[model samples]
Target chain A: MTIAYAYGPNPWPQSFWDARAAANFVCGGAGAGLVVAAALSGARGTALVVPLLAGLAIVACGLAAVFAEIGRPLRAANVVRNPATSWMTREAIVAPLLFACGVAGAFGSLAFVATAAALALAFVYCQGRMVHAARGIPAWRAPQVPWLFVATGMAEGLGLWLALAAFLELRSARVAGWLGVAIIARYVIFRIYRRGLGRALAAAPARALDAAGRALLWGGTLAPLVLLAIAAAVRTQPWAPWLLLAAGLCAALFGAWLKATLVLRAGHTQGYTLPALPVRGTRA
Target chain B: MTRWAMVADLRRCVGCQTCTAACRHANATPPGVQWRRVLDVEVGEFPDVKRVFLPVGCQHCDEPPCLDVCPTTATRKRDDGIVTVDYDLCLGCGYCAVACPYQARHRTPRAVFAYGGAPAKHEAKRHDPARIAVATKCTFCVERIDSGTAQGLTPGVDPEATPACVNSCLSGALAFGDLDDPGSNVSQLLRENRHFRMHAELGTGPGFYYLWDKALPEAAQ
Candidate 1:
């Protein structure tokens, strides 16, 4: 049957073209820089404050990008009001509250309480749900999306703080331990997403997406591993954190790029279906 | 409840896309915006394959994650089961877009203009342009329903009873009616067909139903 359907408006503005491009560069690049800075630093008071502030800034900028992409800005606050069931709502609530907690902890106002650890965890979880809620995009909807996002956030946070310690000429094996953990996480997520890509590769269209993912997993992730090995071998050299910092930066960029590429390549499919057995129909 | 549903018969559907065009015209939706889309999927390799056309849109589910994840409560499912989005209340957060398992929602950009012939420009009005930035999808013509009922006409139908798409359909493949109605064609079709919802593993429980062609090629089998 020739059925009728409706169309809606595209909400983008002329200015959005420039704004989005800028946002991608700054958020994607500067965000990685901040993480590297923090990871090279010590677990001192300054180490906590700078990364906390930078993390908050990252979230704000991320929200701005989201707003720019959406045509509406005023209704952004409403998501928090409906937090009972909405992951978006939950994200809105959790992002700020965690930021507030992190700020308080960094400033030493909430040091005695368990607020810091809780906020850090909350931050990670919120980051995860942002991608997990999209049921339509199978790549984003994978069970591993949340784990990947949260783990990356934590790893980035740790890498940034540790990088700061090294840059500041402070000593801490804890920083190396953290970088090690982040590398491991990046590897694990890459594996999981690889499996998902295999499932998605039924169509020829998904080849580019698969390739982008592979690039990030190999070049971006392995870059840090080489740096880490060098640092471990020459323990006396103070540049180990710097090398780890570079690796962290690459990992964040390549990972986010892989995600964005995969998301953009996604085409809306026939509604989610169970495995269907084909019937002998018309021939090509 | 207003549970919105549709049934498409593979045997009858000609894949002309009358529904797609009518929907665009009725809504005056800008270019690049299709409230409904038909996916032409070709399955199998070489001699083993066949083509199938599938129409998709919002399923208005029983457990709507879109509504659940909308922090602003901008998106909601009516008691009658029709899911509607309040554009003015939307924050353009993209959270709904991400949360929707069906990937039904799209985040509108900050500015909107009519497109087709050329890039038409719009003068700024009093309302914030950000209102359009919110997530959007098919509202099932609720405005038509409200106005139609007020005028003593059945919404989505006439004495001959048909929706725009159903009325325009040349092959009589599209069927729409209350799934709860025992006499409804949609209900009968559902009972008769070996149908399924996409990605049941996601547990979205969408209202749209698909009847696959028994003659589909090896890949789609």
Candidate 2:
């Protein structure tokens, strides 16, 4: 559907926040999710160490991606100055705290584990608000976006946990159960988020986003759940661990794809508008 | 203690785009980056069509969303209500660009010219290396306003102190003045004409006011 705007199309450049920005969202969200899942599972030794290190590395890479995106990377420390208003500032402030706690937690400190989990959640929430604060983009301005990010982050984290478990030959019903719950929550929240976006966006962008959302639901959300269900049913079989691994891979990739689309494709500036006047004319 | 404002009289404006040219010449902005441009809006069907030219740029709002979202504190609204960007502080993250509903902010990472090639002598002379990769927008001719006011001349009354867009307007559609002063040209114009601001519901309290030709039927009585 070709939607006609009264004030013409957006004159400014499209893709203001490009692939690099999308990478930031994908990595940061998944990393924070993994940290939270690790804290919750109480998986000690190699199990905890692997996921924690992987999560932190991904987040650090995301930060580097953002640094590369800025014109002046040398003056990036200025982002920490404005926590009272800017969400980007808040995210910068929380990231170091999250990393510190995660490192301390790895050394058998229960207090650090709890703190890391809390900080991870806060970091995820801050990323969500960063997108939400982009008031020009109708797709990002929805109130549900922040919550959607949180749900997807948790789901992605659980998916990473399962993948690590499968690789390490560690099988735990508690982790699988939590993964199921996280997937369900993410799926539900995504539905709500997509619906809100459809209403808020113009017809053309909305239709395109709707198709992306459907793909995510079927391939990302439901596929993972079905694989996990098969894993649960064939617990005694040799292929059960493989199925869990497949499900984990599917969920993590889906979360990454969703974040990429949100930041890169759905990110559109607010088209121009004229005052309410009864006029019948197309934009020149 | 002056609040800067602009009044674009729709009745007088002819879509010549002189204001756009004047702004470009004065600022020496690169290609594809227009700080000020007149939007040619054609209203009504072809049989009874009426073309209206709307001049648009940074509204310099009292409560600018761009200022609120700037992580580096680069965007700031001055005491006189003209919104400005500190190029040195801006990281060119484009957050302020995304926050502005007006789509006024722009970022040009690379240098490009009208004729293409190495930067022209004038372009190179005018270009500020600090401005590259940072957000840029209309400043309402702050340099002229400051210098002219310092010399004890009124902004709207004196052509030297006024913005290039307002000064170069051929049809005299654009008016710049202190809105806080009742005796100011913009204040008097506002009091006399039925003017409307774009996206007033956003609560940005935009300084740009478009003067309508006739009062609305509901507002007439």
Candidate 3:
């Protein structure tokens, strides 16, 4: 018998959704973030095309991974039937819109870029709410979860944009400044999510979230900030772009790691809790 | 409007698990799946410890979170408040499973028998093709309720109309009836007993009520 069926009253990690679900959050966040950041950065011509295609491809990979996770893949169309109440359905609707705009923006015009970015942001928002809709899992059901996802996605996307900027030799201090802001914002949201949980989560989930927060603080937040700072200081140097690229990679990869931990390791289901225990034969 | 509900009296329970066995037999659920089960919870520390046999399953809440989060519209609630799953439409995405706080949802991707290999005669006969790769849960014996009620039988009072678990309960601890009916057996039980729903603060408005005489004196006290 499983621990759940046997012991029955303790929080345990949910097996229904595994690492496959996390792939959607990680890749989808980074991809959507890249689209939004690229549009906001004002990349024109080939500069815009490269990042847009890359972002769409990444998002497509996430969609494919989730498709593999569903038991009835043929009945996938049924997911779009309830957009009125289901965030997953809303996400399904937004993905195609994002793709259409992304494809058009790659070769069409700057207007398409803005449109794709809006759709991409909506897609990430839907994904965040999708995770939040898992009311059984305390760690995922935080009201701030959607905001956390948005901030982290923007931070990761900005990191990817900066890394690609290094490759494409595109420089914009204003966008880089936003990246720093996003990273710190993500850290702040993570802290709030943890504090809000406050004994509501099981021991295992609480520890897992704390460990992820620690990693986000040191590697994802602090390290990236220091690198971006140094890159700004050495703006005149020929190798400053490399410093920015390294910072971008740190931010994006660490964000991916934290989300993976959130979905897989910290996804413990709420166990049974009786407010007042009843003693047999007690009188009213 | 008739609303189906259940009440479990803590004073009368014996932790025999007869209800669990009966439910599994009636449903012919795959191995490792129990539609209704009792949780043996040992609370408090050392000197004043007490073990409570907590019966749990799908609460079939009035505000079921599972119904709202279903991406495929596979999970539904009847006008009577009994939540159900449409096996044909479900993609088994598990969103409803996670949304359900009761941990009541079950999904079987492939056919598996009680024994190691091959299907027994009874297993093959009971195997539902549509159940494969779909989300499932306790339906509160909807088939019995519908068929029995068609003949003008009232649920909770008639054995044929009641849920299999409530019928098989060894100690008469489990009761099921229309919560909307003030004169119902479950309603009388609720009126006299001090009871509470599990996780009521979550705002699910669960129909499953646990009745106790009074709060047990804490061991620390």
Candidate 4:
């Protein structure tokens, strides 16, 4: 008889960590894009429904990331005890509450609540950054982390709609109208935070910070500008929205990929060894 | 209510995993279950780099996040603010682990036994299999403390009075005490050092604190 001798359990596999990290980063990037796009302009009627739906999607993805990392996904709700002290706790309390706010705002047509949902969207960004902060990884130390994430959420939402419009062949001048706005907002964010991001990219002190800074600028700012130009040109041409939407999709996808790659690579740069001591604890 | 806390003298810690092992034994944790661990990290570079060994575990925070996301009310905070997990009520859900910033919680694939000197005896002493599939972590040796207190071993000491890990520190690196008491060593250390928790910016408001010497070349800011 083969007995499953449950003496000791094994540590979680690398695959688990890898999958969680990849999914989290993608959702985070997309969520950032969405939130920014939603806030960039005012949406009325079912048009408003787009941002709300996007917000709900982001929340779902965030919950999935959380649930996937845990040992028990179902027991996920117990973390609401000290909103005053914990972000994870605050997220637990706020996520559903925020979702409820979105629902109430959507159904009741309350502008104030929709504004509140936008603010809550900012909190969701904070929660995502909070996870990275815990790992003690230097790459996560950026003050713009919250801003970057929120922006990306907005951008992702805009990209989704743009792509959807292209697929549906919908020719609302308003839809074509917002393309430049998304590009400008995304590019501005890149310039602000990523102008001199990394040493290798910036050609300076070779500090990881320098490399990260430059990468953010190029990947976030420069690359998107190129894509946006292509997209804008396509917007003016007949039957070009479809192509522009395709181009936007590529830009968003590549933009997210490049950004995540830089962040992950920066995390790996922190693996340098510490100085040795005669004993362990005391500092020399 | 005495709020228990720990202080590690960075001057003496030897990077040993004795505390980790002791915690496992004391808690009767299963395999792949580590309530405490020794993390060896490198800081700085070249000739100036320094190795720092931090023995980390659940901070048993004044504000425990694990207690927050538990849908089943499986985790709770003691009156003194030490966090404890109820394995029986835990539905093997991993929410609390994610909420924990310290990455302190360990969910074993199955129930485990604290092997005595003899493996057979250890298996015999293991908590019954009927009670498997629950979340758990160090409870500050609550059972031992209660018993020890009754026996006058110490004012608040219990059967597991002194946490096994604290006792196992060969270099006297770890110290535990009531943070609420001004006379307690933990409180005194807090008063003396401008230490910071791992992710202070997140506002987890962790009870665990680290004090690094300013003069140290390799200390992380």
Candidate 5:
């Protein structure tokens, strides 16, 4: 019988999902995060306007980036036709609903804001599933991927909210505390996800992924936590707002970098395999 | 109720790659795009090495991961079990490309010719413009099979209806027929030989079977 063997080091080309696709992940995570933060804060006036406009803009930009990656952009509308099976179709359906609800929420509809927040979470989840559905890629197919994305998206979104709050001089100890919790949750999930990857992946790719995971842990998760603690300690100081802003900025940038590395660099296809090979010292 | 299938007899195959050339010639596929390929795998250490030629393309699974992951509903499986892509409906997002464990799907962003500069007349005429930027893979020569069936011909029995690879296999290693029919050549081959479908544990239920000359130890006893 025919046997399968691992094809080579890298079976598929890296160009399949390029930088544009990575940008989509970053933008999607940030956009969903901002919407969730806005819903949580229930801010008014300039506070509301900043998140509403910025969130929608980032999400729209992410969609545009994905559009740029398609070979036939005109046929992209067909993506909504297979919601029964495709996560991409589900994402397409939820994204517009999130936008509409976010806009309505900004106009003072608390019901719409709540709906937008829920839809934003769903959109983020669908993004994770979109990656997870690639059964050929071991890293993306891990069960922990979606959870990691959800946690990271919320953390990044909350960090953006804090940055906006600092810029607008709005005081919300509750929001800052929630941001801290989200960052901590993200760190825990990131560790578990990396451990899962280490077990699932081959030696070479696993080492490479471990390197990227370490960077994400130090820069994306821990560094922001440190900055947030510093800001908390110096709350009475005049430069407290600046320190909070810096923490938020660092968190957001690191989240983006993490997603970019996961989607673009760490993404690899499952190679070919041959099942039937004679064991050493055994003759056929 | 015709469930199309293929059986490759590994014992008879000479690893000549004639099937590969025949498939390329029949399909007029662009350079670097091999709808069918014979992979030469060298197993064991250098002193006791054995070279085995494995022909792989699409397994044409019963539950195709590619079809399940296609966002555009472009990849479809016919009643006869051939998986195909509707180029018009495909967005070329490469989702199906990655979902395919078989590594069967391919997308060429730009057109290229075997020659450096220009495509030959026959090559230009045979090339499908719709498949340029979209995903494409082996169709099991559906057009020829369908046309032959309409003309009261059996695909496996008729050279005109059979796939290029099967038709051109000089060693009679490749056979194509309806697996549903007990009397079909593929079914008979499966019944008579020790055969296995690749990645069957993945629950793909692949239609392509590989037949080995040696029987299992238990079966031989």
Candidate 6:
């Protein structure tokens, strides 16, 4: 039978992990980043509650998507069995603790919120490692993949916070400044990742990542940075908060877009390559 | 101590896919899944071209990436060095599938018949519900190996004990035996001819070896 996916020098898009898998990375990373962003922004008590709970909810949603993706949902607990080697196991173990701190911080103290943020960071790190563990997928196994995930998660959270700040009526210019800084950092890391990847990726995903990189620069990075700058200049204006919200939305949404692209579009399996071909006439 | 391995004399493989057919008949894998298949690769320019029929499947690497990445501990390597999966324990998360560089692992969401509609009588009878939505792959005929050994038969020498693919090969391209046993057929072949393991630089220490040349000696091997 002619297979849709041919194992050859040219890599083929992997069919195993699909949109549901991408949803986990997208939602999970954003949620983890939001917690870290709130913590770094010095969100305390009442200020911490909204973002913390929201972040936790996002994380839960991501986990739920993953649960739905697995073949044997009843045996899902088995995923936690190999924490010693599998990063997915580590993520599962940490998820509940992260949720615990998130809930406690919702009605408890700032320390709980801070604890939640630390755990969130750990969860995101596990996600990065999880993707990296797929050695058969060349796009995922890059050493910088974990770093990219961590950076994107934090950026998404901070952006969400900046956007949420407008509604909370507890807007801070300092937080906006931090979001800008985070955006710059994320963009830098993304560039480095792409550069390191060079032409290693298959043609299709390489083009996709390049396109994402471009969008990330204009929509995810520069546009948001410019909006933040403009919003800061007109801080007293009635429409200033809206611009801040827009910038935050742009940053957060684009981070998600990047994650989605990486997971879904760039998930190409490592195709076969032979160092040397056997001569047809040879015999031992 | 018996490290089960296979040696593919690449020159001898005709790319006729007799092994592939035998494997499918033995395993009863689904329509899209081919646990053992040959990759016909052409090298060099058009005029100077040469083709090599590479028999590729689960390498059964010593340091199996699939085993380490399996979240549910479903994939395990045996003492005799055969990697097998416990379908009951597997969540079919596909992590191991993607972790395997050989692309040896496979998972299907449901029972897909060879024909479009309802399953044929034989297909329905052979359908393993436990295998549904779980990772499956070439087992190297572990059942045959274990049972045959219990019956006092050596795997490589005994037809009943050997893998169906090895037994079915018309070209005598495929050889299987204990790599640790230097006097074994595979070991003897390796000792006589230069060979290379696929993706060896990845430190997988693949159980599959390909003998490419007789002109090259054991020193090159």
Query: Against the true structure, whose lDDT is highest?
Result: 3
Better model by DockQ, 3 or 5?
A: 3
Q: Against the native chain B, what TM-score does each candidate's chain B reach?
A: 0.82, 0.95, 0.95, 0.83, 0.95, 0.96
Q: Interface root-mean-square deviation for each candidate?
A: 6.8, 5.7, 2.1, 7.9, 5.5, 1.7
Off by over 4 Å in 3: A1-7, A282-284, B214-221
Which CAPRI category fits model 5? acceptable
**Which model, 2 or 5, shows the larger lDDT?**
2
Expressed as tens digits, the lDDT of each residue in A1-284 for candidate 2 is 11122234343324457788888888888898888888777878877778887888878888889888887778898898778899999999999999999898887676888799899999999999998888777778788889988887888887887888787887657777887888788878888888666665766566657777786788778898899888888899987988888888788888777777777777766666666432222111
Error of 1 at A243 (Å): 4.3
Ranking by DockQ: 6, 3, 2, 5, 1, 4
Candidate 6 accuracy as TM-score: 0.96
Which predicted model would earn the best TM-score?
3
Error of 5 at A195 (Å): 3.0
Chain A accuracy of model 1 expressed as TM-score: 0.73
In order, how many clashes per candidate? 70, 0, 0, 59, 6, 1
Every model's TM-score:
0.77, 0.92, 0.96, 0.65, 0.92, 0.96
Candidate 2 structure, TM-score to reference = 0.92
**Which docking band does candidate 6 fall into?**
medium
Query: How well is each residue in B96-139 modelled by candidate 5, as lDDT tens digits?
Result: 87777677777877677777658888788887878877888888
Indicate whether candidate 3 or candidate 4 has the larger lDDT. Answer: 3
> Which consecutive 10 residues in model 1 chain A have the weakest lDDT in total?
A8-17
lDDT of candidate 4 over A153-212, digit per residue (tens): 455556665665565454434533454455456556645555434421222223444554
Error of 4 at A262 (Å): 8.0
lDDT of 3: 0.89
Ordered by lDDT, highest first, the candidates read 3, 6, 2, 5, 1, 4
Candidate 5 regions exceeding 4 Å error are: A1-10, A278-284, B217-221
What lDDT is reached at residue B48 by model 6?
91
Candidate 6 lDDT tens digits, A1-284: 12354666557888888889999999998999888877777767667788888899999999999899888899998999998899999999999999998898778766787889899999999999999989888888888899889888887888898888889876668778878888899899899989888888889999889888899999999999999989989999988988888998898899899989998899888787777677666573
Recovered fraction of real interface contacts per model? 0.57, 0.50, 0.78, 0.13, 0.53, 0.76
Q: In model 2, where do residues sit more than 4 Å from their true spots?
A: A1-13, A277-284, B43-50, B216-221
lDDT of 1 by residue, A1-284 (tens): 11122221111111212335234333423343343334344355665566656755775686577556544445455557786766555656655665566566666663511454555455456555655665555555667867766555555555555455566655646656666676578668857766765755435325655676567667656766677677777768666667766765665566556545544543232243324432323211
